[model samples]
Target chain A: MSTATFYDQVRTAVTNRVPVALATVVRGTSLGAKVLILPDEVQGRIGDDALTGQITLDARSLLRDERSETRPYELNGEPIEIFIESFPPPPLLVIFGAVHVAQPLSRLGKQLGFRVVVTDARSPLATAERFPDADEIIVAWPDDALTQIDIAPTTFIAILTHDPKFDEPALSGALTTEARYIGAVGSRKTNEDRRERLRAAGVDEAHLERLHAPIGLNIGGETPEEMAISILAEMIAVRHGRPGGQLSNAEGSIRGQVTSPVG
Target chain B: MNEWLPEIDQWRARGDQVALATVVKVEGSAPRPVGARMAVSSSGELAGSVSGGCVETDVFTAAQEVLASNEPKLLRYGITDEMAWDVGLACGGTIEVFVEPLSEPPGEKDRAR
Candidate 1:
């Protein structure tokens, strides 16, 4: 396929938030050849038939885990190198309360390249004026708003409504999705009470274990902006599977794995 | 690459030959991850980056060669203990960049048709 056609496909997939992979030949006979891999079909070619087949399989595996890496192969005793780059959709951060904290959190989420969605039943609170940077504002109840969103493994859910009427339903609805981080802003006592209510409402223990109650790291944040920082820090920590500790106290390298949210 | 697409498309539309450099592989603690891209126009205009300002100068020079010859090349940069004290990669990591000229400029496409 032509390079223009390949790039057009890439731009379309990225604009539509579709997961795709691109494999480029960095070494061997067909230098600079590219193959575009979509969910249902693969396009283009990387010169050699055997090398293309092997690279396509590897690209599919990398796309499944949202990873990009280079691999070396031997085609008829000749060294060949290919780079498989996976382009997963931007992660989603759904805030289920348009409170003071949600405002700053939504901005921070947008800065971090997340598709921020701020939802609240109160129409006045969930306005575009409040969350100017949010990609979406859903003025609906927590259950209805959560049901409409396509929550994937890269999604992060934050239940910021302190009231039980709002928090319980949001938590229940969020637990049913595949969100990676489900943080609820509340005190220890409030989290315990919410957990009891969730259990009574038939939320299983496995799902309950996904909650990051008393959200945010122990950073002693007091103001709403500070709390937003701490909460975003915790969300990043959870996404990287870190303990949210100081780098000075860490044992290994400061940089985590190259591929984030490794499955 | 996604972020640089607009600039690349504009460069092609302006009748400038373009070269693209991508970080295909990295080791240890490189500044950028794999798949990072840098686009260089024939007029010396540059967009995006593949490293933390350490290896970009060399990559830019290589991009010029790719643009001239229309031959793609793979370049490797590694930080050794001796070179680390000098002006080489101080990040103590290695990165492999692939540089290639774009297929055709917009003017060329219309002329060929």
Candidate 2:
């Protein structure tokens, strides 16, 4: 693509949360040289080897944050500059149940910037008509769906499936990888049953503890939508390492409490 | 730079002189980190921000001077407790801003018509 078009597309990509990088020659030879790169390949370039090499490294680093800038490098005795921007798409929310709670929970997940994916064995309950907000409505079995794809830290799991047959396998699929948050929508009795099933399947107790059974914060929310709000709030709190308790009830620094610090 | 482009282009398209003030350095708990920017138009209009409303007005003033002088300048705005309340840094941090006037805004002359 032309430089301008590539620049425009890269800009849109960042705005849309699509990962992208731009390479510019900030110093040395071809000081004003430039290029653009996505995850797959180069869309544009700075016209030299050293400059492209320097920018490619910078691009790899930009995948983590909302914005970042790197130091300048020289290309063949010439200064080169490049900026790789990440407009990474929102993380995926994989909900493995078509229960009553999943309806509003999935809707709330979308508002919280998650790309909602609802999957279940039952078709009638998890149809497009019932969930207009869900980006994907998969009628496949949760285990089957999960094994078919990789779940990165950016992916979140909500096992509202409740039934052990669906629930245990989903937990196995999730615990097998590094999905950021794993929560289950169920009652105390339901959670106890889940723990037993998980133990029977050889998932250790410590791993079982990672399950946020009786999912969501103790906000005393009873309704499905309110429950959804609390659940997502808890997920966000876990993701940011924030205290799940109310700030008013807490003491000491709102930051650096309990959790270690990292940028 | 890309975030401020819309306002920058609007001002530049109007043949309005502009000054770009960017925070290149900050010490301690600054309201704005390094690279935070603000664009000031000759009409005294502003686009974007460089602080938590702590020193933007002064930065805008510096930006005006950069526009008038047609030269790039670096300025220090010390805001820490070391500086009294009169210095505008009640938040107790300092920010150094670089103001540059853009006479040849990329792809300007051709678009001016």
> What C-alpha lDDT do the candidate models reach, one value each?
0.84, 0.70
Highest lDDT model number: 1
Least accurate 10 contiguous residues by lDDT in model 1 chain A: A254-263
lDDT per residue for candidate 1 within A194-236, as digits (tens), equals 8999999999999999999998999998898899999998888
Q: What DockQ does each listed candidate score? A: 0.42, 0.11
- Judged by whole-model lDDT over C-alpha atoms, candidate 1 comes out at 0.84
TM-score of the B chain in each candidate versus the native B chain? 0.85, 0.81
Q: Please list the Cα RMSD from the true structure of every candidate, rounded to 1 decimal place.
A: 3.4, 6.6
- Pairs with steric clashes in candidate 1: none
Winning candidate number (TM-score): 1
